[model samples]
Target: MLRLDRVSAGYGRAQVLRDLSLEVKAGEILCLLGRNGAGKSTTMRAIMGLLPLMSGTIWLGERSLSALPAHEVPRAGVGYVPQGRRLFADLTVAQNLEIGLMARQSGPEVREQVLTLFPRLRDRLGQKAQTLSGGEQQMLAMARALCLRPEVLLLDEPTEGLQPSMIAAIREVITALRAEGVAVLLVEQRVDAVLEVADRVAFLENGQGGAVMSAEALRADRGLVDRYVGV
Candidate 1:
């Protein structure tokens, strides 16, 4: 389980999150929905220790992650896929995957697990990341994160800048991850997609959290969506 207790984070002198709090249980997908600059990315960064927390605590299961550094955060069983894919354009696909595996404390068995999910990557292991299509790069990004064998995964805008088919493929992968009991914290702009896949939804506005409800409940409440998540 992952828990954010009244967490507040920001850049130098500019606050992006205001006492935000939320939780994602094991084997569940928790979606964070909001307009651009609503602190969705900030929340993910804070959880991963990419950004320093100004206040409150972040917990992974029974352990506290509030004081860990960014690189050290992932070793604690948290994997982060930032907003951009952040691939190394010069590196081959295999090289990128190798870097991810280096972060893991586990044995070679974890790399085997990642390759099982992204078999396509195995075939194109020698290709440069920049040469791959947008969809393929996205898949590689996800594959790299999974190589760490995280207990909890935080995904930011995973479906952004992709075709419909690619989105569906990624959705299938996420579903499979959940089935394997990996908790996911997903932040996305697609309301319908979030409603379809999320077990629970949290609507964030400005820097504060508004309401937390089940996917079905959020889907049924059109007023709240319009008020906080205008199209």
Candidate 2:
């Protein structure tokens, strides 16, 4: 449902992604694995139109996402939870989610569905985002993105800094999203987490995609993880 073809993007003269090509199909979870500075986050930024592409194109089905402004990208059936969560620290959980709904012009039903996925957020609706624990903040971020009711979801390190239990909860939600037919493009440093939820894995090396493999294949031959991700 989401396609990136020979995408090359960077900040100013320092190019980070070079001729990168990949696709995330509907109902599929594709995890991107790479060490730091491998352009994983850059790929997410390129897809979100936060960084102007130096070359290539990004497409969501037939619509060219590269042509849309950053603000309009989310409205075009794309939901993004960038690394660091980037939540409105001062806003209450409910208010933060409301911003996401407003962006898509979504209704209360969408809010209900998101809250259902993140039940913990329901109890903390009035709590400031900055006051929540690390795991709770992460849940709120994902819940806010789901409020967009997007067909494609871009998640960058959604499980970072969370405890094992919270990690499992986040993974469960990701798997559920796949069952619901949301295309997921995830950038994760945790190999175990990737193996648990990803249908396929793409390795990024020095701003280029090196290999694409099924999650099972990687599980069978974990050496690939060391080769690509240096773990």
Candidate 3:
């Protein structure tokens, strides 16, 4: 489980998140939906310790994520996939995954698990990341994060710009992760994807989180989406 309590963070003196609070429970997906500048990505950065918090705390169960250095946050069982698939472009798929394994000191067994999850990556192990297609690159990024065997996973726009088939593949993987008891915090613009995969949805407005409602509820009342995320 992961919890962000009244978290406020931003770049320099300009704050992006203002007292934002939300939680992701184990074995469930919590999708974050909002307009472009509602601080969705900022929430992920704060949780990853990529941005320093001005106030409040982020907790991974009993562990204080805000207290950890950016580098140490992943070691504490948090895996992140930023908006851009920030992979080592020149490295081979296997090599990129190796870096993730090294981060958690994971072994061959972990690599095997990741490869199994992303069978496409198995064949592309020796291929350079930069040479892969967008969908493949996204798969590599998610696979690398899974190598950490993370308890909490932060994924920002994982399905962005992918074909429908690829998006379905990514969604399937996320759903599988939830079944395996990983706490997922997903920042997604695709309402259909969120409705299919998320257990609950949290909307942000001006960097603050409103009430979290069940995915089923949102599906029943479509107006909520227009109100928070707009058309």
After superposing candidate 3 on the true structure, give the runs of residues whose Cα lies further than 4 Å from its correct spot: none
lDDT of 2 by residue, 87-122 (tens): 999999999999999988999999999998899999
Q: What is the C-alpha RMSD of each candidate to the true structure, in Å?
A: 1.2, 0.8, 0.7
**Alpha-carbon lDDT, every model:** 0.89, 0.95, 0.94
What lDDT tens digits, residue by residue, belong to model 3 across residues 107-207?
99999998888999999999999999999999999999999999999999999999999998999899999999999999999899889999999999989
lDDT: the better of candidates 1 and 2 = 2
Highest lDDT: give the candidate number. Answer: 2
TM-score of candidate 1 relative to the true fold = 0.96
- TM-score head-to-head 1 vs 3, winner: 3
What alpha-carbon RMSD in Å does predicted model 2 have with respect to the real structure? 0.8
Q: Give the TM-score of candidate 3.
A: 0.99
Give lDDT for model 3: 0.94
- Candidate 1 lDDT, 74-179, residue by residue in tens: 8888888887899998999988988888897556777778778777777899999999999889999998899888899999999999999989888988889999
State residue 199's C-alpha deviation in candidate 1, in Å. 0.5
True-structure Cα RMSD, model 1: 1.2
Kindly indicate the candidate among 2 and 3 with the higher lDDT: 2
